[model samples]
Structures are given as C-alpha cells and as structure tokens.
Target: MADIEVFVFAVEAELEAMDRERVGVHRRGRKPDLALRRRLVGLVWTLTFGGMQWRVAGWLSGIPFTTLHSAFARWARLGLWRRLGQRLALDWRLACGDEVLPSAVVVDSRSLRSAPSAWARGIDGGKLIKGVKALAVCDKHGSLLDLELYPANTDDRAGALPLLSRLAALGFQGDLLGDSGFKGAPFATAALAHDIHVSVSPGGTRDGCFLPSGIRWVVERLFAWLSRYRRLNIVYDRAPDLFAAHIWIAMISIISRRLVAQTHT
Candidate 1:
C-alpha cells in the first residue's frame, strides 16, 4: 500500500479507538459515510502537503469552503494535531520496544524563510534567514516529543523551555541533549526547573560535522524528515499555530507508515 494509504488507515484506527466526542466527529445531520470521511481525511492531507491555501480545500473536496477550512483550523485550535502526534509517538515507541516517556530528548531549531503572507517574520543573524524558527524536541529514536514555532530572532534556549515543560507536565524526566547553542548555565538552570537535566553535545563543530556519542544527531534526522514535506519547507500560513499543526501532521504521516511497516517486517 502507498504510505498515505497506510497513514489514512492508521488515522482511521485511531479515530475508532477514540470516543466520538474526543475525535470531534459528530453523527448529527447528513454525516459523510466511511468512504467519504476517509476521502475527507485524505483531502486534509492533500491540502497540508500541497500548501496551496485553506480556501482551496472546499474546491478540492467539493465540501463547502468555509466548512472545510473551519474544521481544519478548528482541529488545530483544539489541539487535535498535537494529541495525535503524542499518541503516535507512544505507539511508535511501543512498536519498537521502547518506553512511552522518552528517557532522553534531543532539541533543536530550524529557520525557514517566511512568505510575504506570513506573519511575525524575523531575521536569524546566526543562520542568516529571514523567517521564523521551529523548535523541535524528539526522543532518541527520532519520534517527535514536542514542538514550538516562533520568530527566528528568539533565542533557542528561551524558545525551548515551554516545549520541555509540556513534556515534563506529561511526567517526562530525562536528559535534554542539544548542540552547543543550548550550553549556557542559564538554559541548564531553566531546564532543571522542569526536572529535565541538560547535556550539551561537546564543543564547537568548527573542526567538522560534530558527530555526537549518542542520539543528538537523531533529531537532525527528524528535522530532515520534516523538510521533505513540501508544505513545511517555507512558512506560508499567516498563523504560526497552523504551520506548527502541519508539522505534527507530517510526523503522523511518517510515523504511521513506520508502524505499518513494522507489522510486515
């Protein structure tokens, strides 16, 4: 089966496992059938992967434009994408015989140029990019644990604390691995506030590519995987949360396939 087919099937399974209220699918009125609902889900993936615009989803799906886009935006606002990402991360860990809560998290940021339509664009003097920064936290196996997006000018140490705190709220207790950008005592002290110890990967990479001793590089791989989704290459959406929602969707698409592939392997 195609990867998206697997992803859709996995999403359907998750929907089945969930209560109707939790998944946000109501049975009132002229509800779309299973096949139609599946198509709607696929249409959502299409809209996300295509990055055309939200208004086009109705034209693509033959559903009312407002209805289509509102549902999509509402899910993001309601935190469905975030919830799905966390659930899949847990399932991925279990499939790979790993723990549900990661023992170690690798955090990093990427700067991408924003489109003229995007908001709060800033310059990252370090990366020299005129855009926003995406802060990502992933486990040793490269599953996304949490994420945040903000203006590129924001300091990495400052932007990452909230993500770590979110994990900590979920009972996460682990070492935080990162590049030297996260090495300062201020950031370490801040991370310790959440009970997550800090461990920066050794000195500058001025010598060459810094090959760490552990899974620090795995988060880079996660970033690379996210880069493949055409929707994520640039910040086109006006709302940063919507853009972040796409990131979660991309991870769901990738991780769901891994789950399916494991069954065959």
Candidate 2:
C-alpha cells in the first residue's frame, strides 16, 4: 500500500477544485489552514487501514485525539467522504475510458465481526458472524458506485432494498447481478420496482467445486480489495455510516494511487 501522505497530496488539487458545497450550516469556527487541512484529511487516510481507536490513530498520525475524531465525524455527517468517493470513482472510470454512467452494476455483501463496543450488529446465521453487513455496489471494473452498511443479520434480499433506492437516486437503471442468495421473487420484485433488473448466478456448488460466476464475481473481488484494509477486516465503528465513510476513504485512496500512477506513466 502507498503511504497516506502521498495519496493525500495526490488528491489535494482535486479536493481544492471540487466545490465544498457544504450542506446546511454557516460555520462558527474559522477555516483550517492548508497544513491543518492536509493533516485532518491525512488522518482520514490513517483511519482507512488502522484500528478504529481515534486515540491510537491520533498518536500515530501526530494529531490530537479529539481533533481528529471530531473532524472525521463532522466530515461523515456532512457527506464529504461520500461525494469525494463518487467523484473519484467517476474520474477513475473516465481515465480508463469507460462510460460516465454504468448501464449494469454488480452487488454483493460481506459480514465482518464487530467489536464489543459496537452497538449496531446482528448475527449472520450462514456466516455465523455477529457484526455488520457491507453492501458494495460496483461497476464491472470493480470501482464502487455506492456502499451500504447495516446489521449483519439482514439477508441479501432484504438488505438490497436501501441499496436499490440509493442506486436509483444515482440514476442507475440496468442489470443488478448477484449470487443465488439474491435469487427469489421478493428481491426481483424489489429490484424491478427501482427499474433495475435482477440477474442471479447459479445456485450451489457444482460437484462440490467452486466456480466463479461471470461478472457477478467482480463484487467478490471488490470485497477482497476492501479486506486489505485492517480496520475494514473487523467492524469497530459505532455507527454504520462511519464504517461506510472509512470504506469511501479506502476506495479514494486506491483511486488516487491509480490516477497518480497513470499520470506518471
């Protein structure tokens, strides 16, 4: 993985250029200096891979515990990370010569074990993990279009409802490919309600052998990529939105490196 500072610096120009468009509020505190802003943003990068303790991350990043914590939560509540991820994902796709809008998307979810302090968790009977569930919607190339996080106990079909609505809001109207876990009338009906077509992969193993299911497996690969971030390997965020924000941070980190590499090449 590349250093956090490198990714922060790489993204500085784009971040500066993108309109703040702050949602609801005339701020009280003065704006942060450029150096402080970089440190604050870099803390978000540290958050991507490190354990969820703000104090630990603060000490490691040479930032104050309360300062980093407040900034992170504020950014998440303000939807900065979400917009940043969306824009960067689009930039990456455009850089690679892909369309502005993806006609089809792959969706998948994984259960991660939550910490004792985690309040929002449920038992996923099949995975048997008592934690949160992450629903990642991605284009065929594995760039995340959007992400949803909730209790692990939520089944594939049921968990997909919010994801479908969010995708619909984002103007996605195409095939939603998934595993057989999502194959059923309920999910298909829900997806169709959003103008999305449901396409499920084959159910069960063939001769007890595992075979990758076409483009649906792209989301599986996306989970693999997310797993590399230590913090994401386990669920520790008190709020699902915070966990989702960290995920966006991780994704933007990945996109930053790719974009920077492309520039150098």
Q: Which whole-number lDDT from 0 to 100 does residue 3 have in model 1?
A: 69
- Candidate 1 lDDT tens digits, 1-265: 7867876787666565554555554444645477865776677777667776666778766787676666567768767778888899988988888878888888888999999899779999977999999999988788897888889999999888788679888789989988887889988998888988999876346766556667788888998998888889988888988888889989999888888788888
Off by over 4 Å in 1: 16-18, 21-35, 55-57, 207-210
lDDT of model 1 at position 74? 73
TM-score of 2: 0.90
Q: Residues 99-169, candidate 2, lDDT per residue (tens digit)? A: 87788898888898998877587999977899888889999889898987878898878877888888998
Query: Number of the top candidate by lDDT?
Result: 1
Candidate lDDT values, in order: 0.81, 0.80
Backbone clash pairs for candidate 2 read none
